[model samples]
Target: MAWQTYDPTIEDAYRKQLIVDDRMCFVEVIDTAGQEEYATLRDQWVREGQGFILVYSIASRATFERLEVFRQAMLKVKRQKPVFMLVGNKRDKQYEREVSTAEGAAKAREFNCQFLETSAKTSENVEHLFKTLVRLLRATKQQEQGVQGPIRSPEKEKKGRKCIIM
Candidate 1:
């Protein structure tokens, strides 16, 4: 489903193939929309999820405040620091915004994740949001596989010839 036209129910699942960083990435998106009735089901999905996007509407302060609940649940279920992206949605509703961008950034800092404000309606920053999350997920996967950037010996460092595998 296209981002702009997607109308999520209590839970909706979508699969899309994206060419992120020149690599084919199969992305499965499970959107719960933070409905309280689906908390148990959301936990199950959380356990199986490799990365998470905790989203709140900039127009709704209540939604923004509830982000911690979602974050804590992800941490509790994942049992490790989870890869996350904090998103303030409905950027097209700037006039109705109750949560400031600074608040979103601060909350992302608290969660130790990347922050972005996007408008699904206008397609503002929507692509960047997903792309950034994919990049972060890719980095996290590389780290887990013990592929941490370029390894340079002292001699190589002095020679200024470091090999980086992108």
Candidate 2:
């Protein structure tokens, strides 16, 4: 489940079309600069234990940098609920690339998240990106369920903590 800006004028209509065609669900559209609003949406999804993929243009260094701050906020708010992947979109723009593939991959690795270069324009690996996220989420859910027997509750798990921040 990936969420992008909800602008019906931009990609929203196309996203809705994809939903109608049974391509996706749980789509989120956000303002490009609305970090607060985006944070709220992300927190909500995280609380529901939903995973997400964050997309950025490899041609835009600023967007790439913003991903780090977003990741930090997610860690601060949701703690450990939702997992994420960092995607380098518009990979077909190799001739005009501003960020190298290795750099993108390194950033993802630093954040302990999956990384992939894709070109939505060319429809290159777009399907695979979403499919991989779904598969990983399912597998993670299964693993969590398998390990849920006789685990300590959140309260009990935090008993020894000297300081609690939420």
Question: Which candidate wins on lDDT?
Answer: 1
Model 2 reaches what TM-score against the true structure?
0.66
Question: TM-score for all predictions?
Answer: 0.83, 0.66
In the range 2-40, model 1's lDDT, one tens digit per residue, is 564746456677766667778666677888888888889
lDDT of candidate 2 over 90-152, digit per residue (tens): 887888788888999899889787899988677777666656666665566567868885345
RMSD of 1: 8.5
The list of candidate 1 runs beyond 4 A from truth reads 1-4, 147-166
Native-referenced Cα lDDT, model 2: 0.61
State the lDDT at 53 in candidate 2: 66
Candidate 1 backbone collisions, by pair: none
lDDT score at residue 23, model 1, on the 0-100 scale: 67
